[model samples]
Target: MHGYAHDKDNYAKRLRRIEGQVRGLARMIEEDKYCIDVLTQVSATTKALQAVALGLLDEHLKHCVSEALAEGGEQAEDKIREASDAIARLVKS
Candidate 1:
Protein backbone atom coordinates (compact mmCIF):
# COMPACT_ATOMS: atom_id res chain seq x y z
CA MET A 1 0.00 0.00 0.00
CA HIS A 2 1.41 3.35 -1.07
CA GLY A 3 0.86 5.71 1.82
CA TYR A 4 0.49 9.44 1.61
CA ALA A 5 0.97 11.64 4.63
CA HIS A 6 -1.99 11.87 6.88
CA ASP A 7 -3.07 14.78 9.05
CA LYS A 8 -0.97 15.15 12.18
CA ASP A 9 -4.03 16.07 14.22
CA ASN A 10 -5.72 12.75 13.54
CA TYR A 11 -2.65 10.77 14.40
CA ALA A 12 -2.25 12.69 17.63
CA LYS A 13 -5.84 12.00 18.51
CA ARG A 14 -5.36 8.28 18.00
CA LEU A 15 -2.28 8.29 20.19
CA ARG A 16 -4.15 10.22 22.86
CA ARG A 17 -6.86 7.60 22.93
CA ILE A 18 -4.26 4.86 23.27
CA GLU A 19 -2.71 6.81 26.14
CA GLY A 20 -6.08 6.99 27.81
CA GLN A 21 -6.48 3.25 27.48
CA VAL A 22 -3.12 2.74 29.21
CA ARG A 23 -4.14 5.06 32.03
CA GLY A 24 -7.41 3.23 32.41
CA LEU A 25 -5.54 -0.05 32.64
CA ALA A 26 -3.41 1.38 35.41
CA ARG A 27 -6.48 2.58 37.24
CA MET A 28 -8.09 -0.81 36.90
CA ILE A 29 -5.07 -2.40 38.49
CA GLU A 30 -5.08 0.10 41.35
CA GLU A 31 -8.73 -0.51 41.91
CA ASP A 32 -8.19 -4.25 42.14
CA LYS A 33 -10.37 -5.10 39.25
CA TYR A 34 -11.05 -8.72 38.27
CA CYS A 35 -8.01 -10.60 37.01
CA ILE A 36 -9.78 -11.64 33.83
CA ASP A 37 -10.94 -8.08 33.22
CA VAL A 38 -7.42 -6.75 33.56
CA LEU A 39 -6.12 -9.34 31.17
CA THR A 40 -8.79 -8.46 28.65
CA GLN A 41 -7.83 -4.84 28.77
CA VAL A 42 -4.21 -5.77 28.40
CA SER A 43 -5.07 -7.76 25.31
CA ALA A 44 -6.91 -4.80 23.84
CA THR A 45 -3.98 -2.51 24.52
CA THR A 46 -1.63 -4.95 22.80
CA LYS A 47 -3.87 -5.01 19.77
CA ALA A 48 -4.00 -1.23 19.67
CA LEU A 49 -0.21 -1.00 19.79
CA GLN A 50 0.09 -3.62 17.07
CA ALA A 51 -2.31 -1.67 14.88
CA VAL A 52 -0.19 1.46 15.23
CA ALA A 53 2.98 -0.42 14.45
CA LEU A 54 1.49 -1.94 11.35
CA GLY A 55 0.31 1.45 10.19
CA LEU A 56 3.76 2.97 10.51
CA LEU A 57 5.35 0.00 8.79
CA ASP A 58 2.90 0.28 5.93
CA GLU A 59 3.73 3.94 5.52
CA HIS A 60 7.44 3.25 5.53
CA LEU A 61 7.07 0.58 2.87
CA LYS A 62 4.82 2.73 0.74
CA HIS A 63 7.04 5.78 0.78
CA CYS A 64 10.57 5.05 1.89
CA VAL A 65 10.87 1.58 0.43
CA SER A 66 9.27 2.57 -2.81
CA GLU A 67 11.66 5.47 -3.20
CA ALA A 68 14.63 3.27 -2.40
CA LEU A 69 13.55 0.76 -5.01
CA ALA A 70 13.25 3.47 -7.57
CA GLU A 71 16.83 4.50 -6.87
CA GLY A 72 17.92 0.91 -7.72
CA GLY A 73 21.08 0.32 -5.65
CA GLU A 74 22.40 -1.34 -2.51
CA GLN A 75 20.26 1.05 -0.48
CA ALA A 76 17.11 -0.56 -1.83
CA GLU A 77 18.33 -4.00 -0.84
CA ASP A 78 19.28 -2.74 2.60
CA LYS A 79 15.87 -1.21 3.15
CA ILE A 80 14.17 -4.44 2.13
CA ARG A 81 16.31 -6.38 4.56
CA GLU A 82 15.65 -3.92 7.37
CA ALA A 83 11.93 -3.88 6.76
CA SER A 84 11.82 -7.68 6.71
CA ASP A 85 13.67 -7.91 10.00
CA ALA A 86 11.41 -5.38 11.61
CA ILE A 87 8.36 -7.25 10.42
CA ALA A 88 9.73 -10.51 11.79
CA ARG A 89 10.23 -8.98 15.19
CA LEU A 90 6.82 -7.41 15.11
CA VAL A 91 5.18 -10.70 14.27
CA LYS A 92 6.99 -12.56 17.03
CA SER A 93 5.68 -10.07 19.52
Candidate 2:
Protein backbone atom coordinates (compact mmCIF):
# COMPACT_ATOMS: atom_id res chain seq x y z
CA MET A 1 0.00 0.00 0.00
CA HIS A 2 3.00 2.28 0.01
CA GLY A 3 2.80 5.27 -2.28
CA TYR A 4 6.01 4.37 -4.10
CA ALA A 5 5.20 0.68 -4.50
CA HIS A 6 4.61 1.09 -8.22
CA ASP A 7 8.11 2.35 -8.84
CA LYS A 8 9.96 0.47 -6.14
CA ASP A 9 12.06 -1.49 -8.61
CA ASN A 10 13.15 1.68 -10.34
CA TYR A 11 14.05 3.20 -7.03
CA ALA A 12 16.08 0.15 -6.09
CA LYS A 13 17.98 0.25 -9.35
CA ARG A 14 18.75 3.95 -8.92
CA LEU A 15 19.97 3.34 -5.38
CA ARG A 16 22.18 0.49 -6.52
CA ARG A 17 23.72 2.77 -9.12
CA ILE A 18 24.33 5.37 -6.47
CA GLU A 19 25.94 2.70 -4.30
CA GLY A 20 28.29 1.85 -7.13
CA GLN A 21 29.14 5.52 -7.52
CA VAL A 22 30.00 5.70 -3.84
CA ARG A 23 32.24 2.67 -4.14
CA GLY A 24 33.96 4.26 -7.08
CA LEU A 25 34.46 7.40 -5.08
CA ALA A 26 36.14 5.39 -2.35
CA ARG A 27 38.33 3.70 -4.88
CA MET A 28 39.32 7.04 -6.33
CA ILE A 29 40.41 8.20 -2.90
CA GLU A 30 42.36 5.01 -2.33
CA GLU A 31 44.14 5.48 -5.61
CA ASP A 32 45.06 9.11 -4.82
CA LYS A 33 43.16 10.51 -7.76
CA TYR A 34 43.37 14.21 -8.65
CA CYS A 35 41.61 16.49 -6.19
CA ILE A 36 39.33 18.11 -8.78
CA ASP A 37 38.38 14.76 -10.27
CA VAL A 38 37.42 13.44 -6.85
CA LEU A 39 35.45 16.58 -6.17
CA THR A 40 33.65 16.30 -9.49
CA GLN A 41 32.65 12.73 -8.70
CA VAL A 42 31.43 13.86 -5.29
CA SER A 43 29.25 16.50 -6.95
CA ALA A 44 27.80 13.95 -9.33
CA THR A 45 26.99 11.59 -6.49
CA THR A 46 25.37 14.37 -4.50
CA LYS A 47 23.24 15.40 -7.46
CA ALA A 48 22.14 11.81 -8.07
CA LEU A 49 21.02 11.49 -4.45
CA GLN A 50 19.18 14.80 -4.66
CA ALA A 51 17.42 13.61 -7.80
CA VAL A 52 16.16 10.53 -5.97
CA ALA A 53 15.06 12.58 -3.00
CA LEU A 54 13.12 14.95 -5.21
CA GLY A 55 11.43 12.04 -6.98
CA LEU A 56 10.34 10.54 -3.68
CA LEU A 57 9.05 13.90 -2.49
CA ASP A 58 7.06 14.31 -5.66
CA GLU A 59 5.56 10.84 -5.30
CA HIS A 60 4.68 11.47 -1.66
CA LEU A 61 2.92 14.69 -2.54
CA LYS A 62 1.09 13.27 -5.54
CA HIS A 63 -0.12 10.15 -3.74
CA CYS A 64 0.19 10.13 0.05
CA VAL A 65 -0.43 13.80 0.69
CA SER A 66 -3.17 13.96 -1.88
CA GLU A 67 -4.95 11.05 -0.25
CA ALA A 68 -4.58 12.54 3.21
CA LEU A 69 -5.93 15.89 2.04
CA ALA A 70 -8.96 14.19 0.62
CA GLU A 71 -9.59 12.47 3.93
CA GLY A 72 -9.36 15.86 5.75
CA GLY A 73 -8.48 15.57 9.44
CA GLU A 74 -5.58 15.05 11.84
CA GLN A 75 -4.00 12.63 9.39
CA ALA A 76 -4.00 15.31 6.75
CA GLU A 77 -2.26 17.75 9.06
CA ASP A 78 0.34 15.14 9.93
CA LYS A 79 1.04 14.44 6.31
CA ILE A 80 1.43 18.13 5.55
CA ARG A 81 3.82 18.53 8.44
CA GLU A 82 5.78 15.47 7.43
CA ALA A 83 6.16 16.72 3.89
CA SER A 84 7.13 20.16 5.09
CA ASP A 85 9.79 18.69 7.33
CA ALA A 86 11.14 16.66 4.49
CA ILE A 87 11.37 19.74 2.32
CA ALA A 88 13.11 21.61 5.09
CA ARG A 89 15.70 18.90 5.46
CA LEU A 90 16.34 18.83 1.75
CA VAL A 91 16.76 22.56 1.70
CA LYS A 92 19.16 22.48 4.61
CA SER A 93 21.26 19.89 2.86
The residue ranges of model 1 lying beyond 4 angstroms of the native Cα positions read 1-7
> Candidate 1, residues 1-93: lDDT per residue as tens digits?
335356456556778888999999999999999999999999998998888788889888988888999998999999999899999999899
TM-score of each: 0.88, 0.98
lDDT of 2: 0.97
lDDT by residue for model 2 over 1-93, one digit each (tens)? Answer: 878889999999999999999999999999999999999999999999999999999999999999999999999999999999999999999
Every candidate's CA RMSD? 2.6, 0.5
Q: Which stretches of candidate 2 lie over 4 Å from their true place?
A: none
lDDT, candidates in the order shown = 0.87, 0.97
Number of the top candidate by lDDT? 2
What range of 10 consecutive residues in model 1 has the weakest lDDT sum? Answer: 1-10
